[model samples]
Target: MRFLCILVVLFVGLKAFSQDSVSVPSIDTTQHTKDTLTIIGVGDIMMGTNFPEDKLPPNDGDFLLKDVESVLKSADVTFGNLEGTLLDSGGIPKKCNDPKVCYAFRTPARYVKNLINAGFDMMSLANNHAGDMGDEGRKSSMATLESAGIVHAGQMSQKTAIFEKEGIRYGLAAFAPNSNCVPLNDLQGAVQIVKELADTCDIVIVSFHGGAEGAQYQNVPRTNEIFHGENRGDVYKFSHTLIDAGADIIFGHGPHVTRAVEVYNNRFIAYSLGNFCTYRGISVNGVNGLAPIIKVFTDKQGNFFKAEITPTYQTYATGVRIDMQKQVIKKIQELTKKDFPESKTQIDDNGLITYLAQ
Candidate 1:
């Protein structure tokens, strides 16, 4: 038997960032060749910043994500966290309290093609660096993604992203505790946005850049996280509430470390995916480099199905590559069991994620 693979050339975004960027369409009840639909998601991806100077990936950023392209494209939809602004040049960098510790990310605009080549269907622009270059940087990043035909959400100007792929309509509502982004602290606001998407789209995938930072904060505190005098919001409550409000999958990041995953009400929630292709401005040492490419298989109605983990990692020199040791899988398994002891999902040593009924 043969099956056709449909690709939606969805160049969806707003010319001018606003609250009404991409509108949600009517519900689509279409299904493809199989009962399960694959949605691949990864953590923060900065590629390389040009802010405080040129720090592009090896060979000027051409071979950044090539090694993992095949795995990324294997899903019906692919997503990542766009950690910084995409612009060739000029923009007002945000003022930092201490310039000694501040880092601004401004990747070359041309590098957007790298994401397209890597099969990134969507991205989350709700991280701390979203306003690195101020308004100009944000606009450039939005326009860059639009030109690449990739959907992005999380910015206040573009709260939710709606696109169709393989006959299934997908909705993405992103949030963060940063400025210019849809505030993650507002639970009702997120619920409202996700509910709207759920009312219209077949699958609603939520992206959030919350939780505290660093390796020490790897564990889910299950309460409002405070880091350096900043309230990072309670990711535990946020994920569960959004899932209850119609979010099919919630991909969390911002801690710069891989966190536990939970299966709530038959929906998938990866607490944090960690750094994927971060070249500079942050450390990829140890757990920080654990980039788990999560391929979530969901039923036609977005109900949770078996998933797989393609463990991958990156460094300042090598970019993203498949991890032969499956370090990410091992780490996730350990973290998940420790954090969500009652979770119905079990991950095997071989990286297969299955739902177990009580």
Candidate 2:
């Protein structure tokens, strides 16, 4: 097994777990003596939802991440937001305020194999659609990822995840503004989780589903963002505080568009990674299709060393494809320059990231 996953008991309809820390038993997991480690993080992923209809891809959706499998596998740890539920059938779709705007994704259970093939080690389950099938769906999703040996945390049930991969222990915590998820607005709670993880693992990473949605909300407001009457939480303050609390990396999503990238206190943060493999229900028009993979190289102490941004895009028919134009890369550069001009990190045309000269 690539991970030593914990057995978390989560009952259907149960709220978020009250505890922030989980104990890890020591093991001889370090097989490599590398000083540097690479981690790749992507945005939302709903491989193929079959809730309202049968929109599964050709060949059972196994080919969704095949094109970029090698790139994804190149990292020591690969992370993505696992949107929606993973179940063949059962569980009721949550009712939406408006039928026209309601979207609930129900991906097949066997599709976890595709993620394994693509080298996904960790997944975040604290997004809006996480409760698409209500609590039952959430439990099923957690169970599926566990069965696949993929470490996941975001719900109150499992707010933190610790696993050993490549001989290094990784701790991840996820947050969202939605109910049942680790509240993104709860900054203190989030800090406690990160602090605990940092104390236990070699690398501590945080995943958040915050900020407003669509292309217009791409910029981090640096303050609390209210979207559609819902407080999306100020991603800027939240990220910085987590970093201060000992988070090594912060990966933000939910804007459905790529946002800025920054290196704060030598820790890397991607405001929003945009949609990765969302198919059918989610729109892929214009910039929404830009699915750039964030590949960060960090030292053993979890300090940011450098990074690369591999630009890619997604299609409703297919899944993910290489973007030769590097449109997302350019978009990130433009956004980062505009959103965080003071950021020490610089992006080159070839998608390399480095610090500016002193």
Estimate the lDDT of model 1.
0.85
Residue ranges of candidate 2 with Cα displaced over 4 Å: 1-28
Worst 10 residues of 2 by lDDT: 6-15
Kindly list the per-residue Cα lDDT of model 1 for residues 70-92, writing each as its tens digit.
99999989999998899889999
TM match of model 2 to true structure: 0.92
lDDT of 2 by residue, 61-151 (tens): 8878989999999998899999899988889889877767568999999999999899998899999998999888988998888777787
- Model 1 error, position 143 (Å): 0.4
Q: Scored by CA lDDT, what does every candidate get?
A: 0.85, 0.86
TM-score, each model?
A: 0.92, 0.92
Clashing residue pairs in candidate 1, if any? none
- In angstroms, how far off is 230's CA in candidate 2? 0.9
List the candidate 1 regions with Cα displacement exceeding 4 Å. 1-33
